[model samples]
Target: MLNGLGVWDIFLTLTTLTRGYLIWKVVNLLTRSTTGSTNVYQEICGQWVQTNTLTMDNADWGTFVRYAHRVKSIVIHNDSLFGNCKTIDVSILRALSMPPIPPASILFPQLRQLVCYDRRDEIYPFVRLLFGPKLTKVDVRLEASRSAQLAVLPSLAAWCPSVKKAELRVWRERPLGAGGINEVRALSDVVCKWRHLEQLSCGVGCLDDKAILHLGKLNSLRSLQLRISSHLTYHSVRQAEHGPLFQFLDHIHMVAIDSLSSCTSFFPLFSSLPPNITISPYAPYRSEGLCDLFTDLSVHESSGVLEDVSVEDHFQSTAPEEVFTIETLRPLLGLHRLRILSLETFYSFSLDDNALKEIGSAFPLLAELSLTADRGSNRHSKISVNGLITLLGLCPHLTSLSLTIDATRVDDIEPERRPGGGISNLNIDTLRLNDSKINHPRIVAAILFDVLPYVDVFAWEWGAHFDESDAEIYRPRWVEVQALLGAFRTVQEWRQPGFLPM
Candidate 1:
């Protein structure tokens, strides 16, 4: 038997090569035979981490380089790396830069898209390793100061010059003092180089007055979504002298706007915006502010060409002064091409029977109308059940409807006699009613049975909408209404010409 230094020599020589060969074989099987397909999309998570440069330091990287060649997308989504967290998707990229990999031996040479997420903003510094000339899309979310998030932009433009789509969100922004302004400047500079950037989503803080002005001039930008901050109000934008703003824009979104002032400040800047627009604000808006917003739209070149315009989240405020009156929404009535109009708020609209009739006549082609108010929002005179029926009859094209109706006086309001049921909302498929103050259940159900006889789905807010007392009293009435609808529907089916007893 061999002894002494011969045994130790074998251990030193064989053990090093054995460890490297074992790691290499495991990685090969994962990307090759294990999946039973060679074309599988690879991710940098557990098992994947073992092939990272740190694990294979000074060993062998031929197997890794072979696998990394086919990777077109790289995703780093890890929650907390400090614990023994099972999801290790966030670790590989951060460790890919050390040792044996070498500085210039680029991995992921064919990478085109990079999606990375970190709660602490640590993974992105190593994200550059995944960037290549062919990269077209980058979506990153990190938690850090505004300046730190802006720093990633410079690297993106440096590596992925022709990126067509970019979504960058920076959460938990700390106080930046004067440094914040410089970060905005940096964002403007970096994006100006993104000659092919067609769609962009970022925080409003990243696009100040000057930055937005430059962005509008980008001919390639078609869709833009700005996540607005309540604290930031854009008031300094002006018409660019060299060219028209957002000339070729097809879609525009202004989301998370906490104030009406924010909407007015930004919407008026563009000479003409996209026909289909989405403005979702988290806070309540006064009637006057909304009126001003629509008035601004009325003058824009896009208003005449507009079809669907939805201002979400901002609803009728509980305060009497904040309610949307017919006059407040008068500007929208002129948009003849408008098909879908949604203005659901927390409270109630001040529009009455006359207003609904006018709206129906104005937009006769309307298909979807959502004017639903929150529960217990009876501060104003709501449209009666008959008023809703008239509006539905006028707009035969209506398919989906969500609104608040007063069915309290369903019996006395209309005593007209009918045959089997009320006029059928034939084309209507979806219906949502914010039931309030309904003393008579049978009459209301009978009336609804006549109107909406063939609804595909009926949306009703139950326990979530009421207090214990409200639920106990009002729930049974609504339940009775639903049961009556079913009974009435059964009779209608029997009345059909080809009905069989079975």
Candidate 2:
């Protein structure tokens, strides 16, 4: 047929077909590009992206918008304006105001995960519409004049039925008028609604006695962590027994307990509950009483199901009892399920060879261990590194270990030297430390290269509080760390993971 047609006509027809194919390919490319300012669609299926017009360039927003309809997750990062605004920018303010969620039929209908870091007042309402029945996870970091936490209760109370994990941060709240009552009211109401909630972290400004009592209503809660500047009491935890608080609870954490002695009768409150509990010794005056509490609770023997324990207070105690060590921990060895252990601030306890062997017999199932020292000048007592290494020999099941080493042999006293070398036959896989005090280059080198060959993850960070010049002068320690880790099975600089510089 082509032979019958003229040569010029045939060539022109072939060129037109080729051009059409090329245009189709370009359209396909454009459709595939999901990140930009403008949303894109192909027939019925499409995606959308929301971009801050003020912050993101036109091209960037275009890229995001192109895929906006398909984007099930969104993240916004911006600081607060006044540090006191109560309102937040609703997540879908722009999208819902404009196109809104498309009317389509699918098994999972709404967006899955929404993360907002904006301080604008519109965030709360935005989250309400975007996270419908289908939302599973919501993380919002907001700064408001009235406190972002005020916005959290309503959003979580309504949507948490579908959410498995939720995190909220608020700046500050002034407890006054009906507004003060509002937070407590909201928390009480929402705890009942969020039946499926598993993990939660929120900063509640003034969680008074009444509000704390209301917290026990979350019966289905498994892992609950609260960071508050408010007062807490035994009745708060006591209310959990008959109410919604401890029905399915296996893990409970309360951090920054500015005053434990203020709640003196609190720890004994959980005696009737199950054995699994974690109490951070962050409150003042936990010295001997704190350790005694752990022993008493763990003495249930058969019911001693307490597997996780963390005591972060390491300051020199006013009490006269010996500092905690593997020897002291020997009594609780009868608590068979004790596995995860963490002790911070007090790192200078002596663990003799016999104690190490006893520890091996005690915590056979132990998996994660973290021992950290306080960086303050209060570390008047010296830590025995050799003894600690010898103690590690007993923990055959140990997998994760994090130690904050003051690396210096002695501070105020004449330079009393510590053991020079590291272990050779330990089964640890991950090791992390902040060893700014140690000036010896080979200290870490000895650990990484000669010892702990089985270790996989090694990390160390210079002290953030050190003077700039000190940090620079100490920068060589980091290099030494790299060199030491390099000689081992693997090597990488330690970047604080999920840790905000305090």
Candidate 3:
């Protein structure tokens, strides 16, 4: 028996020693590979090349150029690198320069996309270099001087015949005289020539009904986004108005309209939109107009085909305003096929238990729902624990949810009747509580866990005015709730083999 025990001890010692040696060798090998100039090329060869300026000496420049073909993307702020290489094979390039490199020096044979934000004087030369057949995408934002010449869109079309996507923004350095309707006509003429272009975004301060009609002729266009000056008007409701622009929207799958004016009218045009389409409007409209817009959408036959709806007040403001009321949203409930709904407001929006119930009952197919207040805004949302429970019970198909509710009065309210009883199975994968004002986060977390025990991702943040010093008072309660949730998950996994807990 003593000899048998000695043999087992020897086996254990040998196994441990072998493992230690292997671990030591691995550590040494990793250390050597990561800690020297010899590995620099290996470290950066496959990565995106980012440089402030090309100030490296000849040796370093040569080394970078030798490995330039391995770079998939590069961003250069200065133009000094233009002369260092005869050829580069980057796929994407972004150059921010005051003066563009000479056209002759630009040599990116394999480039597919290019983004250049430079002065008007440099844009021509920079664009001339990117006029190859392989270039499919281009984004150019030019700063125009007082004497700056307008870039001819025809020239761009002639050079970039195979370009599929383009975004152009021209801003004058100083407030100059506005371009006339003639300029708009000229631009439309140039843009209509791109037969291969599938997507186009332009902010040229001269797009109107005529330009839109001209662009409608492009049979290959799948997506269109236009940023036009607010001064341009389209009176689609007028009896005398008849344009091909409305017909153009019928074939396009996605359209985004951005107007610089605080209030731009598109009601007349939107009424005739395609039944199956995605529309994003970045400009804010008047509250009354917005209500009218929703009412119109609800009654339209195309409302059933609407898949994504987002209303965000992009301007930063502190006080919540009454932008969207429960009554205004009541009409939107008719959109039964809606899958994604996002409404972020700067002002306090009224959302009661009844409204939540109506939403869940109306949009049974909703996969993502985000009802959040703008960041830094003070919100007084009227959502109780019972209301949230009702919503979860009704929306069984929901996978992602974001809610900003004022739960300060949760303790005062009675516990929900049949709390989490209706939910037989939970499909929720992500939940985010924005600026939770709940008296106890643990209680809220527990309530959520009871309904969505399998939720893979959970995030919560306190209200803007929450005091951190008082966290100690709530630490024990949070730990208790977490322990209960953990045990619940463990039991669930044990009962159902192969169950993954989050």
Highest TM-score scorer: 1
Give the lDDT ranking, best first.
1, 3, 2
- Name the weakest run of 10 consecutive residues (lDDT summed) in model 3: 22-31
State the lDDT of candidate 1 residue by residue for 143-255, as single tens digits: 44645555767777887887999876655434222225665566667677787879988744356766677678888988888756545555556634556778778778786
Clash pairs detected, candidate 3: 320-347, 321-347
lDDT of 3 by residue, 1-502 (tens): 1223332343343233222111100000111222343322211111123333323234433432332233222232323324432221121212312123322333444456666544335435435544455667767654433233244455566666677887765554332235554555545665666667777776533456645655555556656655433455654333344553343343222222343231224434543444333333344445565566567666764566576666654443443344456776777888888877776554445677777889999888888888765442224457776677778777777888877555554564336643456453377756565554546756665565777787533223443332344334443444454566676677867789776656
lDDT of 1: 0.64
Model 3 residue runs over 4 Å out of place are 1-110, 117-124, 144-154, 169-190, 203-206, 228-230, 235-286, 299-301, 318-320, 375-379, 408-418, 422-425, 456-502
lDDT of model 2 at position 253: 60
Per-residue lDDT of 7 in model 1: 26
TM-score of each predicted structure versus truth: 0.74, 0.60, 0.64
Comparing 1 with 2 on TM-score, the higher-scoring candidate is 1
Enumerate clash totals for all models, in the order shown: 3, 45, 2
